[model samples]
Target: MTPSAEILAFMGRLGHDFARPEFLVRALTHGSIASATRPDNQRLEFLGDRVLGLVMAEALFHADTQASEGQLAPRYNALVKGETCAALARQIGLGEVLKLGRSEMLSGGRRKEALLADGMEAVIAAVYLDAGFETARRVVLNLWRDRLDTIEDDPRDPKTALQEWAQANGMKPPAYEQTGRGGPDHAPVFHITVRLDNGETAAAQGSGTKRSIEQAAARTLLERLEGRE
Candidate 1:
């Protein structure tokens, strides 16, 4: 089937022409709108996640020959995390082309991080299937060019780093608590506070998820403890 002008335009932004337009269509379909005759992007999202991982791992492996696995692991995670995928999707206006159910649309699904991230992965899978691994790799590399170039040498997760710092200083493991929550149920904001045994603490708020807020709080506290902030 011929792709609509909208899909074609999205393809232009994605830098890929679909040999099988149906794949792109399937990738954009959300579970909320799926039916017996229409499949959701969940399966495609799963496949795309692996494809993205492989592409990122290979790229990171070649980008820094001297970097050890311990260093590369965090960098890879930073590059391919759900937040990064969602950011990429927003950059390319992928949310504009998402085919969501009425309920999802009413709930502002297009702007949702999880939904956008899942869609990004599905699109990657679609590209991998439509062309080949080489083409998919090229597309991914192009999309992530800026990030790949400027990725930190030690982009460790804040929680892990904070835990290590606490342990090294002879302090007990840090504790995190939810101080408050606000906003609508569909997209609530989480307020998290991280505190060490020594009474040092930091608080952060985010709509990305409780875990993300916790990470942010940890980062804040860690930076303060290390005199970086």
Candidate 2:
């Protein structure tokens, strides 16, 4: 079957041309709009998650041959995390091509981070199925080239890093508190504060989710603690 103009344009952005375009279509199909004939992308997302993990692990292993597993683990997580996938999806305009149900579309499903991340993973699975591991790996590496190059600079998750810092400094683990919340229910904002036993603290707000706000707060606190802010 001939691919639509939009799919073709998306392919250009994705840096891959699908031999079986149906896979691409299914990758973009959310469960909300799925039927017996038109399957959703959940299975593809699952497969792609593993594929992405393997690709990232291999890339990190080879990129820093001298680094220990402890050092590489955080870097691997930073590269293959759902947030990273969502950011990459946004770069390629993946949300614009997603096939969502009316309810999901009305609820701003296109902009949802989880949905976009899942779609990105499904797309990777599609690429893997359409071609092979080599082609999928090439596409993943190409899409993540910038991130991969910079992953060594600050690869640890903010919360994890903050906890480790506290432990190393003979302090208790950092405490995260939900200070407040605002905005409408559909688009609520979370306010989080991360405080250390040393009486240092940082606050941040996130429109994305509670966990994101916590991470933001942790990052701010970490930066302040390290005198990098």
Candidate 3:
């Protein structure tokens, strides 16, 4: 099949025209729609994940001259995590260019955070393959400019913080339970409740996935307990 105008438009938005157009096509192809001639983006995603990590690490390290390893680590994790990738994908309209199978399309695969995140990574790999690491690094730095600029210093994972708080207060570890799921299989919403042994609890719904929903619930509980909310 011919690549759609939308795909070209997305490439323009990404600020990189493919040297090999097929790389872009393959990057946009989801696993559910993969064929012998139309390979999926999983391999590209793998490479792109590394590329993204390296770029983020370098950027973070340089951005903060005095930040210890401990401070830089969590900031790196937060920037490279799936949720952040998905948000970046949405910023570039990556979901609009994705090629998905019929079932996935019907099930809202384009909106699924997992798919979007993977697609973003695949696109990064595609850019690297088309040009070089320098080009890919430039693209990533440009795309992630705002996030990198505004990233929290000494970021802490909410779940870890919550667990630490629980232990400090002599309460059992926080327990997370899935309370509900809705929407299609591919784009399901997850509702989760995080409860501490001491009776503090918070519930939250997220469109990302079970892990994101659970994280959100944990963060909400942490905020509530800490009186931040």
TM-score of each: 0.93, 0.91, 0.92
Candidate 1: stretches off by over 4 Å: none
| TM-score of structure candidate 2 | 0.91
Give lDDT tens digits, candidate 1, residues 109-204: 999989999999999999999999999999999999999999999887899899999999999999999999999977889999999898888999
lDDT of 3 at 48: 96
- Residues forming the 10-long window of minimal summed lDDT in candidate 3: 1-10
17: Cα error in model 2, Å: 1.3
- Which residue pairs clash within candidate 3? none
lDDT of 2 by residue, 181-220 (tens): 9987657788888899989999999799677888999988
Q: How far is 136's C-alpha from truth in model 3 (Å)?
A: 0.1
Residues 69-127, model 3: lDDT tens digits: 98999899999999899999999999898999999899888888889999999999999
Each model's lDDT: 0.95, 0.92, 0.90
Candidate 2: which stretches are off by over 4 Å? 169-172, 197-200
